[model samples]
Target chain A: MGTKAFWLATTAAVLIVFAASRLVTNDYVFFAGYVVLQYVVLATAWNILGGYAGYINFGTSGFVGIGAYSTVVLHKLVGPPIPVLILVGGIVSGAIGLGMGYLTLRLRGVYFGIATLAMAIVVQTLVTNWDFVGGSRGVYIIRPAHVPFIGGYIQYLFLVMLVLAAVAVAAARTIERSVFGFGLAAIRDDEQAAEVSGVPTLRLKLIAISVSCGLMGMAGAPLPYYVTYLDPASAFNLGYTANTIAMPLIGGTASWVGPVIGAIGLATIQQVSTVTISSALNLLIVGVLLLICVVVAPNGIVGLVRGKRRRAGRGG
Target chain B: MADDLLSVDKLGKRFGGFVALDGIDLTVRAGERLGLIGPNGSGKSTLVNCLSGTLRNDSGTVRFDGNLLNGLAAHRRTRLGLARSFQLPKPFRSLTVVENLRVPLYYSVNARPGAPHLAEAAVGERCRELLRLVGLEAKADRQPQDLTQIEMRKLELARALAAEPKLLIADEAMAGLSNSEVDNILALLMRLGDRGIAVILIEHIMRAVISFSQRLVVLVAGRKIADGDPHAVVRDPEVVRAYLGE
Candidate 1:
């Protein structure tokens, strides 16, 4: 691992250890932290291609659902533990992403966006009708049959997610600065111009889709173990889609930390607001916030901050 | 004949029954500077699009550096050392001037096996050199939105140069520039050509066309009406009829 990767991994290790200790010490904290961190993983995964390459992927739930459903099916079939199941989910979802790219990456802008959204809907409908994973009724993992000595499974699960989230972030930044990163950025800026400049548009896009979906699969694989239950509605929820995309947009889609900050901020806000407001209106709040961000600070919080700092230095 | 560096033979293109480019034929030597010009909608840009692989030629072959370029994607054509500038500049709006150049420099240079791979700092240095070449180094950190029309044109040239192309087709590169600005762009194109990069200058500015072109080619209604010495091609009776209607 490079310096950035090493530090990120270390930070994730510390966070996981800290969260595990908290799980042992406080049940309420574990409940809250787990939910927020889950968003971080999904949002970070979405950021890899969406933020870096400027390719908007609204079908995030499709990949997540694939991960969750595959985890359940694989575990049921092969009897592997949770960790191995998540890896299976990642591979399956990545394959699906690769396939999806072939069908839709050539389309630009609204067309590409709608194609991904349609894909998510199709996957959701498929899982809802399939009875193997209990169809719409859902499946229960039964809490992984309870590992007796593990006093803080929730924390351990959270730690696992944290490591994944850090990996996602580091990987995203690395790709952003790497040769492929420049290629994607060029493709985003001007597809024709990028091509004319010798950027391999299709190859780069396929690679991005594969990696992006792989990360989403990893982010989602732990859900069966985390919730101890899975249903078509829960597994293929559009809520995941909204969180994965909106957080990146609200935080700054082009930067690594944009999705991280957006996920943590929005997740915590939604968590708190649910107590004082209606849970059903959470997405409504997010929708309104996204609109405001687009109009006022299209660059997101990071852009807003940088604009402020630049102004402040001039003023001083 | 060394197979000509680029051969566009019997190229035909159409947009839904409207013949945008009708049976065009042209060729360029390894380091020859050529100018292609026509009135608006005369198929110059369309030919550029077809030759560069942005649009596949309907009935022709575009062999670049001796490689057949039919049915290849646009970027693949670029990797074969063919690059073009748009009539309107299209810089990556979000990137700094240097970063915009880096995308092409990174792609074209690092993509080819034996080519040099520039680090970020080295890429920045090449970007600055390109900027200085076009007299836009002072605005390296500025966004495209911040550039004046002439500066934008220079930046466009700089972006194309980043690819280190064998043939650079500049489409109306001086379209909106002042007289002096036009001279600046013409000078820059000349400088690129002097570096042994064959150039295709597509311009309507008669002086820029005449002065910059070693040979002039004219198109009327998508057909090549004339291709010869600049002084004689413009005076050809058919070229006159096509231009001023005799």
Candidate 2:
């Protein structure tokens, strides 16, 4: 489908999913579906830099750590009742993303990838050692007072994440249509040609990374509040980084629906596997999907569908 | 703006101790057609790289339209109306032919302050117009991989033209094309120059070089051997021995 039609359908689907989610009000269903939305937000955020711009960030976990910590610290002082806390997560993560991009944006391909991985390691290490937020022991989040009749606390978390997911997807769409988006696409194609075309490439790249990281951070911010717990290892869990990349890659990088499809599909598989099979096997499923996408359908599912349509269109 | 659009003073680039370009001084007046010809490792591409901001000069200054262009990034220089085509065509593989035009048109139009922004439809139309100029409009919706050698070269020219550049550096655009194809490309570059776009043609094809260039420059071992009339520069003993190898 074309971009405009795809967006309209996505909006309708989101509303249906949200309303349907409200029907299943148990703690488990609320928690599991909310987790999927979190993945959707994080994965789409990652795609802003990785998929559309062709910049692979292995430091996604590092940005998540920043987001989680920022939310934990802020909520501990005040409370989660303020809805603006969600946006704060994005802003904080985006700032760190800017710093990371400035230092590593010039690095490309694997060298840049390795540098970002190292950055994640560094952040994880620092947070682990720092005692202010419990260090190795982790931070304790006292879940804030929930206003009655706004549904249960878990439902509120779901809505917060749904809106965040919406913002992430909307933001990505806006960037994809803008002039800066064209510059990133050019940089992805040929840096030299882009430079001579007058793209202000570094500025554009930095902006993309910042926006991407900020959204990712916001995705993680509520985790500490929802769970009422935070530790360095869980907050900086490297698995989150891999999921962000694998989901988008499997869904199809650079397309509007790529990350969403990848996120929802992978999260469902993980949820089913966690219940019936083994929690450890969840990653294995994602890994297999990633490998299949890389080997057979490098463009991901959306790409496959679009390719088939185009081929059929041509044949007719 | 000065009558000369670009002036290079003692520009140089080095890979380790091996100098790729050395003390190359040159000037191109507005709307000039200049041919930069050299042998395989003679630094034609290097000069273009430095002029187009792909490489930072190890020493010296590059000024465009009386503004210092050295130290500015490549795209920024392009915004200042300096654009170059790659020796090998590198169109955005995922984008359609017409979409390729939007990149430079937006890059040039957005990076400047006074330039008006075109709507998406206008941008798409302008892209088609550029493809038409280079005779690639019929294939506007096709991907770059769908293009043949001459068509790919045409796409590259269309992309460069989309920048609305004051000076366009066409880097070996006609290479690996048929003789008729070479003439077609020559006709296209001449048309661009006719529209008052300054052009620097880097080519190994001597026939095309002689026909397209109003002035010629020869580089050998990272240094300029001759810079003057195309006929004399090609015939000069040092230039002929070092650059032309005839």
The DockQ for candidate 2, computed on C-alphas, is 0.76
lDDT scores of the candidates, listed in order: 0.84, 0.84
- For this target, which candidate reaches the highest DockQ against the unseen true structure? 1
Per-residue alpha-carbon lDDT of candidate 2 for residues A1-316, written as tens digits (9 for 90 to 100) = 6668867876887788778876775778878888899999999998989987898999888988888888777776776553666678779889888998999999899988999899888988988887776898987877646647656778878877887787788888778777778778888887766776667778888999998998888887888877777898888888898898999888888765799999999998899789889988977988888898988888899888888999999996
Best prediction by TM-score:
2
| lDDT per residue (tens digit) for residues B1-246 in model 1 | 565898888989989989998889899997788988787888998998898888877897778998989998887777778888999998988788888888878788767777777877887788888988888879998889999988888888888888889999999999878899898788888988789999999998889989999999999999999999999988899988877356
Candidate 1 collision pairs:
none
Off by over 4 Å in 1: A1-13, A16-20, A145-150, B119-122, B244-246
Residue A195 in model 2: shift from native, Å?
A: 1.8
Error of 1 at A310 (Å): 2.1
Model 2 misplacement above 4 A? A1-15, A80-82, A144-146
* Local accuracy of candidate 1 as per-residue lDDT tens digits, A1-316: 5666767765866666675565467665666677787788788778777877778898998999999889888867876876787788899999999999999998888899999999989998998898888888889886643354555677667666766776777788778778788788878788888888888888999999999998888878888888887888888888999888899889988877788899989988888787678788789889998999999999999889988998898796
DockQ of each: 0.79, 0.76
